[model samples]
Target: MRTLLSNIKVQVNPKIYIKDPETSVLGRKIIQESIILIDEIGFDSFTFKKLGDRIGSNESSVYRYFENKHKLLVYLSSWYWSWMEYRIVFATANIADPSEKLRKAITLVTEKIEDDATTDYIDESVLNRIIIAEFTKTFLTKEVDLENKEGFFLIYKRVVNRIVDIITEISPDFPFPKSFASGIVEGSLHQHFIKDHFKTITDCNDDVSPTDFYLHLATFITKQP
Candidate 1:
């Protein structure tokens, strides 16, 4: 699976960038450095000038690919989810049981991520950190509705929809698969965050993980054995 996925491109929304970062060496370098920089100093403190210094490229060069940091973030988030969508599809492809399929999908979303060696430019492990820490900022803006209409979050919505489909398959009578799916995806990030920062609040830790909690919820809510 890793070998097959290595050849696949994690496509992002073209609207998210002026030039596709995956298209050129310089563009890829911008993405590679930006992920490291954002994870190090945080998204709020991240800037194109700082990125330029890190990549040894002019500030305007960064702008050629991305109009602003917000779009760049959206691009990164889209790429991450697109990669995840591919993974979920591959992981759940041959399972005969909906329960097991849902478990795999849930684990994919909720567990600690590892970097994929396939995409030499982007780091999934650090990108997961950025997603966990800063993904919400992408849609917390006034233009979110407009962006949504423009399909800036299509891949994210699709990933959640896959979970929703799996949940619905497990229990056709389930009352709120969409809500449950969105909650699991978003809430897992919250749990992981608090598990690191506010350890007193979340049960996720070294022994327990966000995946275990959500998988339990899936069984309990779906009444699956």
Candidate 2:
């Protein structure tokens, strides 16, 4: 079976290759089902057996892909960044303007969170906690180095740098440093995930969308005293 898996053609065109295509596809399906379960049952109650049942597989079969829950959560966490990269890149690829690219970046980042289906199955408070504890914090580890061109944050960083390069083309006086700009974007998404809290605890309006929050931030940054 390992040999057969090895011989299988993953990408018809060698230019569009994926490492361990069969395993990766299976891993993706597992992660998706896991998210659904995590939403329905809450992360504390979600289990591999439940995930396997949802995917029409036995628990051992699930184990063949993910050794345990921790490993599975890592993949799921990684997928969030990966998916974010895909969305931002697709949204901004055609635009030649740096500011417009930034706008699209903010839009995609915010809308992605607001549009998340997990909101339906999971409580907002619990989901926010999971995202903050797991997904948001996932960005800070030494694993940042493990992120190649494949992962979301790194790819997103590249996109930001490219935009910064363009902004530098337009105005060197602009104070939007690359790392700072990326942080602003990250913080924007982070804030959006906790918008309800922001409204309750701070001066924010209830109608604030991710894009609106980002636009306000962008304006503030560009208008610094």
Which candidate wins on lDDT? 1
User: How well is each residue in 49-110 modelled by candidate 1, as lDDT tens digits?
Assistant: 99999998899999999999999999999999999999999999999899899999999999
Question: Which one wins on TM-score?
Answer: 1
TM-score of each: 0.98, 0.62
| Candidate 1 TM-score over all chains jointly | 0.98
- Candidate 2: where are CA atoms >4 Å away? 1-29, 112-133, 137-176, 202-205, 220-225
Give the worst 10-residue stretch by lDDT in candidate 1: 216-225
> How displaced is residue 167 in candidate 2, in Å?
5.3
Tally clashing residue pairs in candidate 1.
0
lDDT, candidates in the order shown = 0.93, 0.54
In candidate 1, stretches whose alpha carbon ends up further than 4 angstroms from where it belongs are: none
